[model samples]
Target: MNWKDIPGLDGVESPGLLIDADAVQQNIDRMIEIVGGPDHVDRLFPHVKTHKIPEITRMQVDAGITKFKAATLSEAQMAATAGAREVLIAHQLVGPKVDRLATLIDDFPNTQFAVLVDDPHAADAINQKCGDAENPLDAYIDIDCGMHRTGILLGNPSDALRAHLDSLSGLRYAGLHVYDGHLHDPDLQVRTEKVKEILGKVARHEQQHPSPRVIVGGSPTFGIWAAETSWHCSPGTTLLWDFGYGNAHPDLPMTVAAALISRVISKPGEGKICIDLGHKSISAEMPLEKRFQFPDLPDAQPIGQSEEHLVLQTPNAASLHVGDIVIAIPRHICPTVALHSHATVVRGGRVTGERWRVTARDR
Candidate 1:
């Protein structure tokens, strides 16, 4: 089935997110299969940052995925409300976020929410705000394996930081949070070796002080981390596969579950057409040509884009007319999903009249 085609797409609006419900379920099942099987679902803590909708979170919970990783307090709340057994706010908390997290914990008693801390002072701040909560707040020490983005170096210094966390009176030292998002080598062997090297350092640190639970990997190195039976895996973009990860890692055979629904607005010139999918509709982080892919018009070249319009030069533009539906798969689905408040659901080649709200799009 060409999951991109929507049989009853006329009812759907342009410049909005279109989600294939069946494809999303297929992706969920495939993720469970990749991490072993239903019995091994515990090893999968898929990140909820990709699709912030609570309905998708509920689908994962129904698939036996208990834990989830989130990037914001709102996302954590959405997961907890969606019946997630545990939710980890991967970002460190400061200022009003600390208190907001405390409230979230209090509100969601059934869900155990955790946060990341890379410094001792930050740990103290978290404790001060959440120490007296009904449930003991779970905290993970963010360790930098290789990506110098936002973690403490993995060595004696990380050991010392863990010691400081363990000493905190209110916070429970959950484990280590190592996110190697920067590692995305196309060669599986090369990527696997680099992951093993990072884990080797982690294993050495565990020799003296072992972490109770270790969460590692993003969508790029999810397969590598899944092999390590002891650690948990967190892969976000795999839920809604995009051109960015799909093109880079061909080994991961996940389905593209979401696409941008656009319509041709005009025939500007010879072999040139305009669409409403500007930077606002799709994620513009990648290069102009790399931002989106037209499955039907494979040769469509994005010549120009602005806040409200995207001009493309396609050989088939002469055959196309205004109001023709055009579907595009975004290079980065995560941020594109955030641009819309809701997404129209498509199943069995037709619109299901169901819209999943991007409930956690705000900060």
Candidate 2:
């Protein structure tokens, strides 16, 4: 679709992922400013999996942000190649993936790389692979602060494990990696309390070791660490705010940066309209209301969704027909961004005739 040709957004076409460049830049600036100032941009090890685009990473690098966090080897390689001084593979690598990670470090000797480790066996695999490459790997202790998804439990004798890893060859202790993925309470006070309680646990763990560079926060609880000079905050989604957090945390000093520009396709029935936006177009993990927000059609409700069809029922259904375009703010912008191969760039209320590729997708 020729997005630039359309004078009005209604003609931009269906299932189009439109990204606001101005808003993204604003977000980048605010993020840097929040965690101290532009001078302290290096303190943020931003997770790049949210918007898997090289353009975004380069924007950050150009603005003097050095450190980055990634979920997969592909993202780590992308960040390193994009001129990041340090890249942290926030997710653990095991078996053959360990060597691939080691090779990434070998491939880009200029860029320092580290991975998170919760298990000694996984650490052994990574260290052995790095040993084969005549290099010692840096590793962070993944401490579970509440999110049981990954990382070692805080009470699992993590200090002993930390001691054991320090003795192992071909590996250096980077720091403690604490991700409170579960601390996203809508109430700022509640979130703040939860953050302090969990971060206190992280602090105690650090006291035992004395100096493990603590990396914490996800988009929600970043404010807790924003003023904290010692803590390296890793807030990825804050770079591109979504409705999921935005709707909940109205007090979070950030704007809705990314959006999905989808056009209406068919009127399935009375008061029901079917848009081309399927579950594939945006993130379907959250509930209906939390998945997407429609500013144009306030009453628009996602009644059903499939691969290529999004059935909606709204009070203003009669106002929209086939080919009428609408803007949707995804509740979860991360997966929605990953859904598109490229984002149609818009600036000053006009298409810039450029596309930002979603580089490290599904890897």
Candidate with the greatest lDDT versus the true structure = 1
Residue-level lDDT of model 1, residues 180-219, one tens digit each, is: 9889999999999999999888888778777799899999
Model 1 residue 292 lDDT? Answer: 92
Residue 280 displacement in candidate 2 (angstroms)? 1.3
Off by over 4 Å in 1: none
TM-score of every model versus the real structure: 0.97, 0.93
Q: What RMSD value applies to candidate 1?
A: 1.3
Candidate 2, which ten residues in sequence have the lowest lDDT sum? 1-10
Highest-scoring model, TM-score: 1
Over the stretch 1-363, how does candidate 2's per-residue lDDT look in tens digits? 232233556545568788777778888888888888877777888999988888888989988899999998889988988998999999888878887876787799999898899988888877777743345677888988888898877755677668878878788887888898988788888898888888777777667666558888888888776754368999898878887788788776787767788778889899999888888899889876667878778778778888988889899988887887777888888889888888887777677777888888858
**Which stretches in model 2 have alpha-carbon errors above 4 Å?**
1-13, 132-134
Question: How does candidate 1 score on lDDT?
Answer: 0.89
lDDT of 1 at 114: 86
lDDT of candidate 2 vs native? Answer: 0.81
